[model samples]
Target: MTNPDKTGLKPTCREAHRLVSEGMDRELSFVERTRLRLHLMVCDGCTRFNGQMALLRTAMRRFPDEHGK
Candidate 1:
């Protein structure tokens, strides 16, 4: 995870996952989204991870609650 600008933004798979996870909870900043996209473009593993996370998000949204509502 190398920080190209030393601004704490790591353009690596780990960082990409972090960004993706954070994005699920809140809107990522422009720089964060850009960094994550760039990383996903070059990393198949991270790309798949990002897709999987998205799928999980969608599934969770449609899941029934414990009360079975």
Candidate 2:
């Protein structure tokens, strides 16, 4: 869906960016998650970015301390 109409609606790319990071850390409200999903549907960059973030997170979890001390 396009940007929100008149009274503060869908998340913008900037907000979606924050949402992407937020989603990784904590549970988002249904409204927040829905807005992010809708944004990702239309924004290719964000979609890919989100995927990459998820992948990075997964890899980190799979291989802890990639940079050994």
Candidate 3:
């Protein structure tokens, strides 16, 4: 289980995943970004997940335009 710091960031893997997913749709607050960054620094799984999400987001963005072409 991850620990919360002074900023009360939940800092858990679950929270990290939630933040990463949410960030895809909307901008996270400073605290949320900080917490997710800290978690990603130590958790390779979440880091990979973040990267995969980025790749997926990119692919999804291009999917419609490519289909139209």
Candidate 4:
């Protein structure tokens, strides 16, 4: 999708979330990471959401063996 920012930048929250969530395991193009970072900069809600997601990921990793998965 041709996402754009307030200043006509090539970035948006939807693209950022996808990169942060799915692109982490694979190689993220520089543009994707840049877009994610840009979205995190001016958007506190998305920033906090990203932080929480990271925290949850860390917690799950730490307790992976605790759950009988």
Query: Backbone collision count in every prediction?
Result: 0, 0, 0, 0
Q: Give candidate 3's error at residue 28 in angstroms.
A: 0.3
- Against the hidden reference, what TM-scores do the models get? 0.81, 0.78, 0.79, 0.69
User: Could you tell me the TM-score of candidate 4?
Assistant: 0.69
Instruction: Give one digit per residue, the lDDT tens place, for model 3 in 1-69.
Output: 534453464477778888899999999999788889988999999999999999999998778774576
Model 4 poorest 10 in a row by lDDT: 2-11
lDDT of 4 by residue, 1-69 (tens): 542463354456676677778764787877777777877889887788789888988897878485576
* Candidate 3 Cα errors over 4 Å, as ranges: 1-10, 65-69
- Once fitted onto the true fold, the runs of candidate 4 whose alpha carbons sit more than 4 angstroms away are 1-10, 66-69
Residue pairs in clash, model 4 = none
Q: Indicate the worst ten consecutive residues by lDDT in candidate 3.
A: 1-10
Tens digits of per-residue lDDT for model 2 on 1-69? 634532355567888889999989999998888888888888999999899999989997888575773
Candidate 4 yields a Cα-based lDDT of: 0.73
- What C-alpha lDDT values do all the predictions have? 0.83, 0.83, 0.85, 0.73
TM-score of 1: 0.81
Q: Each prediction's Cα RMSD?
A: 3.0, 4.3, 3.8, 3.7
What local lDDT does model 4 show for residue 29? 79
Candidate 2 weakest ten by summed lDDT: 1-10
